[model samples]
Target: MRLTAEQIASFHEDGFLVLQDWFTPDEVDLLRTETYHEFGNDQPGRILEKNGAVRTVFAAHKSNDVFSRLTRLQKMAEPAAQLLGDEVYVHQFKINAKLGLDGDQWEWHQDYLYWLKEDAMPTPNVLSAVVFLNTVDDFNGPLLLIPGSQKMGTIDLDVEKKYQQLDVAESWKPTLTADLKYKISKRTLIRALENSRIVAAKGTPGFVVFFHGNTLHASAGNLSPVDRLSVFISYNTVANALQPIANPRPTFISERDFTPIAALPDDALLAPRNGHSSPQREQLASLAG
Candidate 1:
């Protein structure tokens, strides 16, 4: 779990690192079974599937034994602690299953961008660890990352609008002006020393990938017949500031009561609102019970 100097440098420089076979086959099977069991039984407010499986937020300590065990593993927590400097909390943890059929592709956006709201100060106290629960190949649409994009800090809102437009248009073929803007924006964030490569990381079920919160990443639609499953644990240093934004009707736990975990200096990120109650909250209340 102790990252070598080279591994640490690669993550800092390129915004991500891939550790092969970080989980054993048994661990992967246990986690996968528990996740599927939890999702299938409709355990209160557990799984949310619009196009694919998205679990709501659960306190790290309060999660099921399988999940809690995964977090306790040194191989998983050590690198996370290294990045966040020892004292950290699991701000979020959930199972994300992309069924290899016709799920919606995610927009290319920074994880912390939603936090940049009206008047909030940012904190540098977050990182994410994604443990592949199944072997991920191009057929199942593995993750794609923009190397060193985290150093770009938060992307400009104006520029993000352009990316969104292109994404929605499903236009890999851009106009001259659009292509120029894309190149300029992409160039500014990527590191000169590193090459931008789409990660077709095919590893054992237990392999783990770590990335900075601001890293620009996207996934292609799942077209294969099987499901591509991943368990994500998001860690945040205790010193990180948190605020809550109001949610009138929330489908996910993150949208309802979860607080923002990390931010950059001078940026305003929205946090979850405190003291909220709704049907969704009531459903999730059983986790505490």
Candidate 2:
């Protein structure tokens, strides 16, 4: 489907767009079935966690058909072409399934903040598509976004310092470790917004949500018996190259730096850049399968 000028403007203004029924019902069912099957069987040596009644499974790319389909979907590729104005490459992809009543809440933050190192200009070519495989609601932890926040760019070091001070004054320790402090700071920033609202996205499956990489978004803990599953794919324009770097944070983290594709064979689906696969991609594939 063609995007209207209004939709495009909304995206530009708010850094995100929620398209209803972007995928067919049949397609959504297929993905959901595949994901549940994979999670139940525990393929690819992946782990499953259950907090109270909520259950979740994680996987990487090249290990599952769900991720493969998501990365190759024309619905995603078409809009990405319009947004990036050139060929694009998949930077990361994953399936996040929150089942039951015990899913943990996600803190508000720009995704790139987790990737940034030292003091560098944040890349602008990146975008992400979150495809809902099931209905999402307050009880199941629907996503929340702060409109126009992407324009704020990366979190300033000084702003972060101030947030820390506030956290200390409030005697609030979100997570047990300093590594999680950044995520807490993000939540504090979003809470400060006067017009924030919970994303009311629930109902038919295959609804795709696109957001700028720098958009501030998060979700509450799942408190329902029904499951909430979403396929998240990270995309980047060909003009931008993925930079590889080692973890520079003082605390232990789970994510890795993505690199550009080095070369491409004629039959390859994705055009080559100068980078390689990241560990996150591997995990996504494993879960998808």
Candidate 3:
């Protein structure tokens, strides 16, 4: 769906926008099924927890048809293009399955920091579309965003202690171990946002949240009984593709494809089963099959 002028303004001001029921129930169900059935630990970019539960599955769009289409939908891509002010391409695709107890904490940091430091992304011309496959609420460990932080530019290293770009380029790799602390000083983050109220990224199934690439955000470990599943699709402007680097990450982490995204029809995911002639019949079929 096309974004409203007000929505765009809000995003620029707050660094994020939440869309309720962006996808229909049938669509959410179809995608949720794919999340559990289509992913496995054998993949190159998969990261598991200490208990061996899948924490993040990267590059699902490249392998799964449903996800491949979902990421390119005009509902998401169109708005991303408007925000980036250029044609967009997929930079990263991942699914986070924060299982009941295995859902680990993701430290406070901006996504642009990761893309800039490790992935060799030149500018902050990227954004992420987060879709809730399962309900996200306070107890389930919703993502937290510090509003208006994107306007501060990239929050990072001290000038004197800065890593030489060449030295950092040759040696550093993206690792989740202390990932949150690595991007920014956790203690410093606490002090900077001491006056700001945190926004919990909670929503129902089919709900979507879009945040700027440089938005300061984090998620807590799941302590609730039920699991939380969220789909994150990142879009980078084709002109802002990865820059030359001394060492590069796997293609799954930083996609090599710079093709402009083409969106499917709005109803593509909610389309009926073949041979279903009536709307009622289609509705029942979606629920049954």
By the lDDT metric, which is better: model 1 or model 2? 2
Score residue 264 of candidate 1 by CA lDDT. 16
CA deviation > 4 Å runs, candidate 1: 41-61, 116-121, 158-197, 244-289
Question: Which is the leading candidate under TM-score?
Answer: 3
Q: Please report how far candidate 3 places residue 136 from its true position, in Å.
A: 1.0
- Residue range 96-180, candidate 3, lDDT tens digits: 8888987888877788887887788999979999999888988888989988888779876532233344354333333453243
Clashes of each: 12, 19, 0
Residue-wise lDDT of candidate 2 within 1-289, one digit each (tens)? Answer: 4477897788888888899877777667767876777666544323334332323344444566445545655567667666656666675565666666655667666766654532121476678888898877767888788787777776743335644565332322222112334553645574547565445555567788888877887777678997888877777765664444342321112223333223222112222223457664554336434
Error of 2 at 175 (Å): 12
Clashes of 1: 12
Cα TM-score per model: 0.68, 0.70, 0.86
What is candidate 1's lDDT per residue for 1-289, written digit by digit as tens?
A: 4889899889998888999987667667767787776566554345444544553323332446556546545566667878767555565566666766844454455655543331131564577799888888877878778777787787644444654565432322221111222222454434422656545556768788898878877677678987888877777655664555343212222222233222111100111124466654443334323
List the candidate 2 regions with Cα displacement exceeding 4 Å. 40-60, 118-122, 157-181, 184-192, 195-198, 247-289
Best by lDDT: 3
What's the residue-level lDDT of 146 in candidate 1? 76
